[model samples]
Target: MRSFVYARPETIDGAVSEMTAEPGAAYLAGGTTQVDLMKDEVLRPVRLVDITRLPLREVWSDGDALVVGALVSMEELAGHPVVTERLPLLREALLMGATPQLRHMATMGGNLLQRTRCRYFRDPSVPCNKREPGAGCGAIDGFHRTHAVLGTSAHCIATHPSDAAVALLALGAEVRVRGGEGERVVPLTDFYRLPGSTPHVETVLEHGELITHLEIPLLPRGARSGYLKVRDRASYEFALASVAAALVVEDGTIRRAHLALGGLGTVPWRVPRAEELLRDAAPGEESFAAAADAALAGAVARPDNGFKIELGRRAVVRMLSTLAKES
Candidate 1:
């Protein structure tokens, strides 16, 4: 790794000030993703502002919402009593992600900000728009079996690789960001940006901004939620297609539904149209199929990834069916 200046800030204001003053300064929490990128030379920040000492490691309930601090580790959140009992879908998504060792070190904010695993983006040798804008994307024509099918632009087609983010999106979570000016709460749906002409910019966060926490409204009493991941392997692998679903059924009729997809889009894909189709419908294969169709309606596939469209549709149907059964 390259040599860089390091600073450990005791306060959020100090960290933001130090980072804002430097053009190439990065916040370091668990360093799970940042260290890997630095080792690969994909990211070379001039300074590292360590915010591990910041008082952001608390998870609690606030009225009808669950508040999760950015510093909370994946394992810690997955095993927390309140999380397991109240947000089982999130717990399942967290557990299905990286192995135990990584979960212990990966924080909630770090996981959401983790970069894509695209080979071209990771290897500095290849041309990738995400790694270097206007350089062209090699994954567009290269082995793109794992590339995205939804929200793909001619400039980039890399898939997002965050299991937690998909579940969080499905749960309608909001992010709390702290910056030089002040603080703002951004909805999770609006946080991620599509891979448009500017694929290099993936999120709405500014350069010096720091994610403080996330808030998710608690589900209703009769709600049933779960997560399903289909990958090439059973363990220690990323999802090929995954779904996070929550449904509320009343007297054999669906009252409300929320569905989000991962491993098939440039961002964590939320299918509001699919959710709308499920409303007031009977919980059956026909309704599930219609919702699945709506989920993949705008999907466009490359030569090597056309199978993902069908795979993603099946994942949606299966996840919804499982949740409906639970209800």
Candidate 2:
């Protein structure tokens, strides 16, 4: 790895000041993904400002919402009683992600900022528009079985690789970020950006800003929620397609539903069309099928990932069907 200046800031202001002063400086949380990327030379920071001791590690309930500290590790979240009880979908997503050892070292903020596992984007030899602006995307004609099928531009088709993000979007989670200006709240759905001309810019986070914590709004009691991921392997692999669903069926009719898809978009693709279709519709094969169809109405598929369109639909149907049966 290339040598870089390092600073351990005890306060948020000190960390922000150091990060702002140093161009190409990155905040170090758990250092799981950052260190690996640096080793691979995919990321080279001029300075590394350590924020692990900046008093951001904490989790608590704010009356109706679950507030998760940014520095909280995936392992801590998965094992937390409140998280497992209140946000089972998030817990399941994290459990199915990286192994125990890595999860213990992966913080929530780092997980959200983690880049795609696209071969072309990771390897310097391969041409990738995301890695190098207008360099052209090799994944378009190369191995792209795991690429995105929705919200993809001709410039790039790489998919976001966070299962936790999918569940967070479904649960109406909000992110709290601190910058040189101050703190601000951004919805989880709006956090990630669609790959337009600039696929390299993946999120709405401004430079020198730091994610502080996550806030998950209170969902109705007795609501069923879950995450389903389909991959080439059963475990320790990224998703070929995935769905995060939360539904509330009342007297055989769907009263409320939240549906979001991952592994198929540049961002966590929330399906308002599906949500609208499921509203007041009976929880049955026909209704679930209709909702699934509505969800993919705007999907634009690539040559290799067209299968994801159907895979994503099947995932949504299966997840909703299972929720219906249990409810």
Please give me the total number of clashing residue pairs in predicted model 1. Answer: 0
Error of 2 at 184 (Å): 0.6
Q: List ranges where model 1 is wrong by over 4 Å.
A: none
| Clash list (residue pairs), candidate 2 | none
In candidate 1, what are the lDDT values of residues 108-226, reduced to their tens digit?
A: 99999999999999999999999999999999889999989999999999999999999999999999999999999999999999989999999999989999999988888768999
Among these predictions, the greatest TM-score belongs to 1
lDDT of 2 by residue, 1-327 (tens): 899999999899899899999878999988877788888888889999999897778999999898999999999988988777777788989999899999999999889889888888888887888888889999888898889888888889898998898888988899999999999999987898988999989889887899999998766778888889899999789998888898888887889999888888877789888899999988989999999998877888767778989998899899999888883
Please, what is the TM-score per model?
0.99, 0.97
What's the distance in Å from true for residue 149, model 2? 0.5
lDDT of each: 0.94, 0.88
List runs of model 2 lying over 4 Å from the truth: none
